[model samples]
Structure formats: structure tokens, C-alpha cells
Target: MPSAPTVIQHPPRREGLGPPIAAGVVTALVGFTSSFAVVLAGLQSVGATQSQAASGLLALTLTFGAAILWLSWRSKMPVTLAWSTPGAALLASAGMVDGGWPAAVGAFLLVGVLILLTGLLPVLGRLMGRIPTALAQAMLAGVLLPLCLAPFKSLGTAPLLVGPVALCWLLLLKLAPRWAVPGALVVALAVIGIHLGVNGTYLPADALVPRLEWTTPAFSVEAAVGLALPLFIVTMASQNIPGVAVLKSFGFTTPWRSSMVMTGAGTMAGAVFGGHAINLAALSAALAAGEEAGRNPGQRWRAAFVSGLAYLVLAVFSAALVTVVAAAPPGLLEAVAGLALLGTLAAAISSALAEAEERVPACITFLLAASGLSFGGIGAAFWALTCGILVRWLLKPGPLVRKARGSGPRAPRQ
Candidate 1:
């Protein structure tokens, strides 16, 4: 007899924690170090007075941190959002010349709108699909590599300042993987405490007070072509792409469109609040996704929420937060950031050059990215992709060379 219909049973799935929570916390610390500095740098270039820049910084901190917290919490995903550091660099170098604060704000708003459109448009999804995986991986490596280097470079000036933090980070990584970041922070803080105890004073505080100033959006040919386009490209190519990859790397699958939507909406909020731009945070996501958040990926949202809440608190007292962080000797900040990013850097390099076919191109991309070049109001992140493509094309085998030798399938000779 045809067998009675067979019944199939599926096992219930258990939610668990990942490696990202601890990673997220550590990465967030590093991410926060020079991140706001980029924005302030950009603002200064664009002619923002000290007070305007301070307000802008406060807005950016609050906006990005809150976004990460809210999205992670509501989505029950280890999603994280952060300001686009690369984007800030682009502004600092090129965008400042084209338009002032008004232009920058307009560009930010436009980027948000573009991201929103990208989220809503199915065609954009297909386009994202079309980017070769190897190329995308290389792009991420290119963008993150500089951040990984800053910590080490800062060492030349302040080895004593950075040594203990570096040692603490490495030791914690080896002996207690989960506590590495927190442990390093503790050591750094302890050093600060000791130095202060002996000296009876830390560095004097640099107070920044937020003020209200509304910049009306201004549109110009130069601003649109020069400032806006570059901002959009960096935010999308360098920031959002890697952000999504980090999530997928951890087995989280939310629609790319949805992420685009969140970023677009978030950017708008930031622009209104005097912030430059916000995007997905790859490094911080690593922290929120780590083992400390809980085994269930779904529960890691709490860490994100906590981070966001912390960010808001920082925003409220941004002058104080920035002052404290900035007070750390440049070398120490650099060392801590570099040490924290060691793992992420290793991973990006490994993935970018994994394929023999892509290695030369990827290497070229990485080098260009590390060179710290900016041009015509765009950053190295864009140039790296451009150079990588050029390398791939130049290295491609000629069709004539392939056609000259092969005409027909040969019979197997035994």
C-alpha cells in the first residue's frame, strides 16, 4: 500500500547569545574615541563656530546612540547604528569648501532621502545584489583599515600612555575573552586614577554647550554635485554596506531594504538635530552581538539599548563626555582603539584577499585606502573602490589571447 502520509516534526529552536555583545562594547569604546573628533573637524572646516560645532557634536552623539538602542531593542536583533566616521572625514577635507553649515545640512538631508528611496525601491535591492561579494568584502576592508591603524600610530608619542591599555586589552583577550574591552577600559581608568591621585588634578575640562541654530537648506550646483553626492556615496558604500555584512556575518537576516529605511529616517532626525550623518556601525555591532549580550541573538538588543541610552546621556552632557575622552593622552586613545580593532582588522584582511582572483585588486584597494587621500570633496573609501576596479580591469586577460589558441573540444586520448 502507498504508505500512509508521513508526519514530520521539527525541533523547537532555542535563542542564544553571540560573540558580538562583548565585541560591541569594546568596539563601541574604540568607535567613540576619534569618531566625534571627525565631526568636529568637519564642522570647523565648514566654518562652524565653536558653539555650533559643540551643539552639532552633542546632536550626533545623541542621535546615533539612540538609534542603535531603539532599533536593536524593537527588532530584537543585535543591530547597531553609528555616525559615519568616513563621511565626516570627507566633509572635513572637501565638503567644507563647497558650502557652509547650510550646505552640509542640505547634503545630509539629501543623503537621508536617498537612503529612504533605496530602501523603498526594489531595483536598488537588485543592484546591491549585483555587487560582487569579493568586491564588497574588499570595500569593507578598505574603509575600516585606517581606523585600525590610528591606535598604533598614536603610540609614537605616548607609549607610556598607551602601553598599559594595550597590554590589558591583549591580556584580557587571551585570558578572558569576554572581559577584554571592559578590562582594558578599567586599566586605562586606573592609570588615570593613579596619575590624578598623585597630581591632584586631571586635565582641565573643555566645556561645550549646545545652542540652537537652525540652518535652512541651501541648494546649489556646486553643493549638489560636490558635497551631496560624495556624502551619499560614502554613507552608502563605506558605512551601510559593511553594517549589513556584519549583521549577516552573525546569522542575522533582516531585509536590506528595511535597514536602508532605518538609516534614511535616522539621518533625517540627525540633520534636524544639528548632526551630520548616521549609519550602521560594524564595529559596535560586533560588541552588541558578542557573548555577553546572551546566547540568543534576539536578546542582544538589550546591549544596543543600553548603548543608546548611554549615548543619550553623553549627548545631554556632551561637553563633559568629550572632555573626558579627549583628556586621555592621544597615544593612549590611539593604543586602545588599535588594540580593540586588532581582531576586526584581521578578519577584514583575511576575507578581502581570500580569493586568488581578487587578491591583487583587493591589495591595491587596501593600499589606496590606507594612503589617506581625499579629492574633489570625496574620501579614500570611494577612491579605493575606484582603484580596485581599475586594477581588476588592467589585469584582465585579453580576449584575443584566449581566442588564439582554442577552437574545438578535443577528444579524450586514452
Candidate 2:
């Protein structure tokens, strides 16, 4: 027989960086625009003044932006980082600690320390893993419940302002779920602008410029347990661990030790300027790692690197964005924030109630979190986790954890 013709496999054509660049831009915009209001709301709830909250937003944007740049560049793994949206929701529910804004800042610092410890100690990471997924998710859902109700609550009071935003959210949610919150936010900004124009309120002269304000940290036992511990747990369970899973699903491995250290250190530094927390990006990581960035996985890190660059650019507008959001008619921005979190709330609920046997404990946890119950100056989030775990153990008296890889549960998509 004639020798078969030799065949050579050819590599994919280079798309000239356009695809990755575009995906990077989308990732940054979606990541930043989607949950920034929650960050502002969370900071304000924990005793930050509007200017301080603005500073917090600025700090978070800048720190995470820098972290992503360094992580992607060093690892070339499309590693991205984000402010912890669930952590922010937890803060929004926790309210002001006994130590006030300084206390909240201290809690943020402690959360960083915990993240660092988790990276350095395998035991600690496993301890975190041992928290039953149902309880952990239930705790997150509970933390989110009150905030998620804002849009509907606003409908009863400020329908004229909130209705349009809600409508925009609904339309996009059905048509393009990814853009739903951002679309709603745009509608809210328009409403704010119209209301401002009619009422003759102009944005502050300095509001357009970004400012970083520093606060001295004060550690309190209450803040530590109430804010810091829960913040760390939520960030780890809901962001970092899932971020690893996300990258893995796309055939990549996260540099867990290095990323934890970087994000931990970055969170500590940002806390001084009033940020809450930062962690590996979860939902948004897909944008960079997916085929949309390019068919070749090796080059996808460019998408993330470019996203980090875009975030740095967005950081410049953080203060201005906060100012505009703050200027909105009451409840308008809350509606937007609520809309932003709806998907998260749904995911949390689903996960928390996934196992038939775990339903009762999860329900109790959810109710406590939603009730915003506080005792001994500790917020409900901590207590909810405690109670849920206790209930599960008391009721079943055995390992209740859902089977998964060596990590906590994957969080709901942001």
C-alpha cells in the first residue's frame, strides 16, 4: 500500500488580542458596576460616613485592581480578584459594631489575617472546609435576605423612582441575565439625574475626583466575632474557594497559597482606607477563562491582565460613582443593589436547601439571618452559622457535608 500522506496539526490562528481585550473590558465593567452599590451600602451600614464610604469604595477598587494585575502577571493563569459581595451583604446586615467605623476597619484587618492564616496553615483551611455547605450557604442567604427585599420594599414607598429600575432589571433578567443589574443601575442613574435636574441638585465639586481617606483601626471582641470572623468565612466560602473551582472547570489550577497571601495582604492594606474585604473573583473569572477570551487557553491570561488594567482605570471614577449613587433619590440605589443581589440570594437558597435532611437547619439559619437578630453584640451571621451547625449535628449526629473536592461549596454566581 502507498504510504499515507503525512499530516501536520496546525495551531489556532491568533485573534490579535482583540477578543481577550474586549472580554477584559466586559469583565471589568460587569464586575465593578454590578456590586459597587452593595459595597457602598455595606460600608455605610458599618458606620462609614458618605465620604468615608466613598473612600472605602475607592480603596477596594484600587487594591483589588492592583492585586489582579500582579496575580495574573505573575501566574499567567487568568487569576482575577473582587471585593466580596457576600461579605458586603453580611456587613450591610451587621450594622454598626460597638467600636464604630474604626471597629469595622479593625474587623476588616482581622479578616485579612485570617485569610493569611488559611493560606499558611493547611489545618485552618480544612477547618473552614468542615463547615457543612448547607449551613454556610444558609448563613449567606440569611445575610442577604434583608438587603434583597429593598427593591420590593421601595416599590411600596417610592414606586415612581424604583418602578423603572425594577422594570429594567426584569426585562434584562429575562433577556440577558448577565446585564440585568447593570442595566437596572443605568436606569437608576437616569432617574437620579432627572430628579437632580428637576430639584436643582448638582454633584459636589469635589465628588468628581477620587479621594482616599484613612481611618485608624480599633479592635473589639464584638467586631472581631461579629464582622471579621463572618467576613472571613463568607469571603472564603463564597469567593476564593469558588474562584478556584471556576478556573478549574476551565482546566486551570489556582495558585491557592500565593493568591491567598496576596489578597490577604491587599485586604489589610485596603482596610486602612476603609475597604471591607477582597477575594478571588468567582463568577467573573469565567469571562476571562472562557473561549470568548480566545480558543487557546494559554493566552487567556491576557484577558485577565487587561481586566486588571481596566479596573485600575475604573478606580479613578470610584469616588464620582459613589457620589452619584449617594445623590440618588432615597431607595433608588438600594433598589439597584437589591436587584444586583437577587441572583446571589436565589443561589444561596437553592444550595442551602439542596439536601432534604438539611432543610430544617437551613431554614432556621435563614430565619435568624433574615431577622437580623443580635445578642451579646454579636451579629446574626455568626449566630446563624453556629445555630445551623448545632441543629444539624443534634438532629443527625454525623457528617452532613455534601461531597465535593477539597474545598468549600461553590458560591452562587455574582
Candidate 3:
């Protein structure tokens, strides 16, 4: 027999600057626009002063920015960090605690400690790793469903403002998919500008100056059980776990333990300046880590680094950005957020329903999550995951065994 033909392997193509830059800019825009207001509102709900709210946003952006840069550089992977949007939503709903913002800050610190402990403890890390991808994706889809519906709802409420933005997004999706989100953003900004001009309202001058304020944390049992525990649960279930799954879906290897540790530390650092929680990013992670970020997967880390830089730059102007967002028409931000997240929402649904055996359980998870129900202070995300897992165990013990044996659907490689 002739000797086997020699195999040749080509190295990954080096990515140019454009893809990374575009990816970075998109990631920044989506991350900032989608939920910064929720963060501001949550801070205020807990009784933060206007300066405290601005400081919270600034601290969060800076903390996540540094975390993303450091993690991506260290891992040589696109590792995006984010403040926990769902957790902020939870805070927004939870309202003021007994000790006010100080108690809430104390609760935030406690949550960070819990996250850090989870990372340090092998059992907790293993448990998080064991969460099936389908169920996790389902929960994510559920968490995102309400927000995803915003554009269509906006179309009915403010057709002039949202119709053009949606049309631009669709057109760009067909003609230049990479620019679709940015195009939508441009249309939204233009509409906002027109509205401002027509309404004779201008952005506040003081918005440009970044400010920082600190509140001394006062721990309270009410806040700890009510805010801290629930915030921790939602952040992990709705954000960090899905974030890891997103990375895995893109064939990236993530050191989950280290990521958890870093996010926990970042959250703690941010809490000092009134920031609530920081964690891994799911939707924006895809923007920075996916094929759009770079032709070569190996080089995509640069995109995350660029995103981090963008975030840092955004932090410097966070107050100004908040002012502009606040001044925009009621549904404009929702439209922008929905457009940017459409891709992520579709991907999550696809992933959730990919396996025939897991479909029922995944659907259950999605429905419960989308229902947005909370009980005894715990959010729906956790309950959704728990119910799905229980149903999976009860209905398909065989597949569950295989899953436990590491032979099920090869969940995102890492």
C-alpha cells in the first residue's frame, strides 16, 4: 500500500481591523442601549440619589469593561462581561428595602460573595456545568421574550418612530446583515433627533461630566433574603449560565470557574460605587465572539478587547448617554433594543428546541420563564430551570443518565 498522503493544515486567517471594530461597536451599542435604563431605574428604586445612579452606571461599565478586557486577553478568547440585566429588572421590581439604597448595596455585596463562593467551591461549579444547554437556552429565551416583543408593540404605538427603524433593520439584514443593527440604531437616533428638534428639548449640559458617589452599605435581613438571594439566583440562572452556553455554542472553551470568580470580584468592586451586579454577557457575547467578530475564531478575542475599550469610553460619557436615552420617545429605546436582540432571541429558541428528546422540557422552561412569575422572592428563571429539570428527570430518565454520563448532545465544548 502506498504511504498515506501527507495531510496539510492551513493556519487560521488573520482578521483585519474592520470586523473587530464593527463587532466592538455593535456589542457596545446593544449592551448599553438594551438595559441601562433598567439599571438606572433599579438604582433609583432602591433610593439612590441621581448622582448615585450615575455613579452606579459608571462603575458598572468600567468594571465590566476591565473584566472583559482582562478575561479575553488572559483566555485568548472573546469573553464579554456585563452587568446583570435580569438582576436589575429584579431590583426594579423589588422596590425600596428597609434600609434603603445602603441595604440594597449590602445585599449586592452579599450576592457577590455568594458568586465568589460558588466559583471557589468545586461542587457549585460542577452543578452549574451540569445544567443542560437546552434548558439554559430555553430559560434565556423566556427571559428575552418580553423584550423581543417590544418592537412590534412599538410599531402599533409609535408607528412613525419604530416603523422606519424596523424597515431599515430588515433591509440591512437582507443586503448587509452585519450592518443591520447599526443601521437600526442610526434610524432610531435620527428619529430621536427629529423629535427633540421638533419638541424644542435639548440634552442637559451637566450630562457630560461623569460623577461618582459612594453609599455606605447597611446590611439588613430583609434585603439579604429579599434582594441579595433573588438577585444572585437570577444573575446566575438568567445571565452567567446562559453566557457560558453562548460561548460554548460558538465553539469557544471557557473556564467557567475563573469567569465566575472574575465576575464576582467585578461585582463587588462595582458595589463600592453603587453598582449592583456584574456577570458574563450572553447576547453581547455572541456579538463579540461569533463569526461576525472575526474570520478566524482564534483572533476573535481582539473583538472583545475592542468592545471593552468601547465600554470604557462609554463610561466616561455615561451620564450624557443616559440623558439622551431618557429624552428619547418612550418606545424608541425598546425598538432599538428589540432590533439588536432579534438575532440572539432566534438563536436561543433554535438551541432550546434543537433536540427532540429535550423539546418538552425546554418548552416547559421557556413558558415558565416567559410567564415572569415569582414566588417567595425568587424569580421565574430559577423556577423554570428547576421545573424543567424535574420534568426531564421524571419523563426521560434514560436521556438524563446519558447526560450525566457526558454522552448527551455534547453541550458547548467547554
Candidate 4:
């Protein structure tokens, strides 16, 4: 008999809770401040009432909070979860459908089912994996372009308030990159407080009470093909795929199927309360799984648990949270969001342009996606990818021609 293969395991290591606690807090703050306003706007664009929007926020936080806690504990990894920010952006751009919020909720449910199916079927996962990374990144970049421009555009309107926040962000980025966004958030809050003191009673006092609202789903063919399909594609391509990549970069073995099932379940739970979608977090995951989270890799899961606890607390105050976000100055919230996403935008652009042969198609995808075009009720993101793939196929040398020329099989680009 052949000798048994040697088994290797990482040594167990644990540390004091201080680092993990800090990491958890940072993760929570970054996750919430970075995109909560966009989420609220997305909900309202689809005709959600103020109460419904608050409930959506609450539902998203609670569902993902529970997921982060359970997945982290069970997997012994820092598996942070977040609402699908790109999906929210897509909703914001798409506006209302014929059936209004009910139709949007139906689309969300359909997306959840699709995500669940992808998890249960290996073939679906493999198909998603085969989507070109350059095109996907280009599409995401296009989706983000308009929102990322908000900071500079706000300079003319709220120069005094926006200036200091931008300045603080830059200073913090240079001095302490990890705390840059939080520092910018602190500045925004300070400005808001001063404005409130001068302007008087911006936010309602009773916005603190937790409220839940439900909308019965009403499916539409337009929404199913337009919103549901695009939401599913972006959530998987831009969020879940990169989320897994983040974990792999940190040396964690991803349990992809289980994560998808859990996220899909969370999305479905959120849909009943008017939330759009929830998925694995990419940026926040890095903060929780990085070296800064803990001295011992084995204990980083504690950070995710703490982050989940913070999310739970936020959920309890969801009504107040939405009110405060609503009270912010026009364009100010977007400025803050834009600043927070600059790094993500940079990374996406770089990734999209890295492959020389794919550059033209990627650029086409980016331009079309950024155009915010809609056709037959479908969003530009879907069309952008389709066009890019078509362009790539057209530009490639034909197999028969290559064989006639005595060239061997061409190697695929990464």
C-alpha cells in the first residue's frame, strides 16, 4: 500500500480581543456610511414610502448581520456581509416600473431564487465563472462613474462644507489610510451638526423608533427580464465574485456554495421588507480579514461577529438612521460616498484595462454602461456585457483560418 499522505494543518493562534474589536467597529462604520444613502435613494426611486424605506434598511441590516455572525462562527473565517451596493445603484438608475415597489420587490425575490439556484447547481456557478473579468470590471466601473462624479460637482453648491470634508479625507489618507473614510465621516457629521444648530430641526425627533412594513410581491414580465436579470448578474459578477477573490487573496478557502445559499436566503428575507438585495461584502471583508483585524488569523472571525453585533444595533435604530441620512445637504451625501469609493473605482479601472487585447471591448462596455441607457426596459449593464462579448468574438481570428495557417490553438488571456 502507498504511504499515507502527510497531513498539514495551520497552528492554532489566538490573541486579545482588542484588535478584533477595533476591526469590527471599523468594518461596521465603513460598511454603513459608504453606501446607506444610495440604498435609501434606490428604495425611494422605486416608490417606497419613508416607512417602507426604513423598514428595508432594517431588514437588510438584520438579515446580513445574522448571516455575518453565523457564517463567521461556523466557518471560522471573517465572512463579512453587505447589501449589494451596485445592485442598489442599478435600481436607482432604473427608476420605477409599472407595478412600482411591488414589482421591484417581485424582482428582488426572483433574483434571490436565481442566486439560490446558482448555489445549488454547479453548472451555473461554472458559467458565471467563465464571464470575462475585464468586461465585468468595466461594467462595474461604468455603473459607478456617475456617482463618483458627485464630489467635484458638489464643490460649486456646497463649497464650504464639502471642501473641509474633502480636505480631511486627503489628510487622513496620507496620515492613516485605514482611518481615512471614518475621519471624513466624522467631518461630515460635524458639519451637519453645525448646520442643524444654525438652521434648526432638520431631522424629525421621532425617527428613532423601529418600524417594519411589508409589501406583497407582484411580478411583471418587464421587471423580471429588466431588473431581476440585471440585478442577478451584477450582484454575482461585481459583488459575489470579487468578494470571493478578496477571501482567496487573504489565504482563506472559500465555501462558495454555502455562502451563496446564505446570501440568497438573506436577500429573500430582505425582499419581504422592501429591501432590494444583500450579498457578500468585498471591501469590508478585507478590513475584517486583514492582518489589522487580529494577530492570529484563527481569531479574525471575532471581528466579523463584532461587526454583526454593530449591525444589529444599527437595525434597532434604522428609522433614525434613514432620517439623518435624509437630512443631509443636497449632494453632500454623494460627495462622502464618492470619496469612499475612489479606491474601488481606481482598482476597477486598472483591472478593466490590464488586458491589452480586451481593452477595446472593455472600453465599449464602460462607455455604454456609463451612458445609463435603457432599452426594452432593460438596463445598460446587461447590454454593455452583451456588446463587449460580441465585439470580442468578432475581433478574434477564426479557428478554421488559424488551422489553415498552421497555427496551433491560441492561448486565452487572463
C-alpha root-mean-square deviation, candidate 1: 6.6
Q: Show where candidate 1 strays beyond 4 Å.
A: 1-57, 65-78, 85-106, 129-148, 177-252, 272-274, 281-311, 328-335, 374-379, 398-414
Return the candidate ranking by lDDT, descending.
2, 4, 3, 1
Q: How much is 64 displaced in model 4, in angstroms?
A: 0.7
Candidate 4 residue runs with Cα over 4 Å from true position: 1-14, 400-414
- For all predictions, the C-alpha RMSD in Å is 6.6, 7.1, 7.9, 6.5
Score residue 123 of candidate 2 by CA lDDT: 93
Please provide, for model 1 over 255-356, each residue's C-alpha lDDT reduced to its tens digit, 9 standing for 90 to 100.
566667877887777675456678888656777766666676667766676667666655765565445545555455445544554565576678778899
Task: Give the number of the best model, judged by lDDT.
Answer: 2
Q: Write the per-residue lDDT of candidate 2 for residues 172-265, one digit (tens) a residue.
A: 9899988888898888989999999999998878878999999999999999998899999999999988999999999999999999999989
Q: At residue 161, what lDDT does model 4 achieve?
A: 88
* Error in Å for residue 20 of model 4: 2.4
lDDT of 4 by residue, 1-414 (tens): 999999999786647899999999889988887678678867887789888899999999999999998999999999999998888877766778778899999999999888888889999888887888898888878877877788899988899989998999999899988677778877887888888788986566777687778889999988888788878888898789889999989988767888889989888988989878888898889999999898788889899999999998878877976777677778777788777767877887899999998999999999988898888867677788889889988877798877787966889999
Determine which window of 10 residues in candidate 1 has minimal summed lDDT: 15-24
lDDT of 1 at 119: 90
- The lDDT values for all models are 0.66, 0.91, 0.82, 0.85
Sort by TM-score, top down from the best: 2, 4, 3, 1
Best prediction by TM-score: 2
- Clashing residue pairs in candidate 3 (N, C-alpha, C atoms within 3 angstroms): none
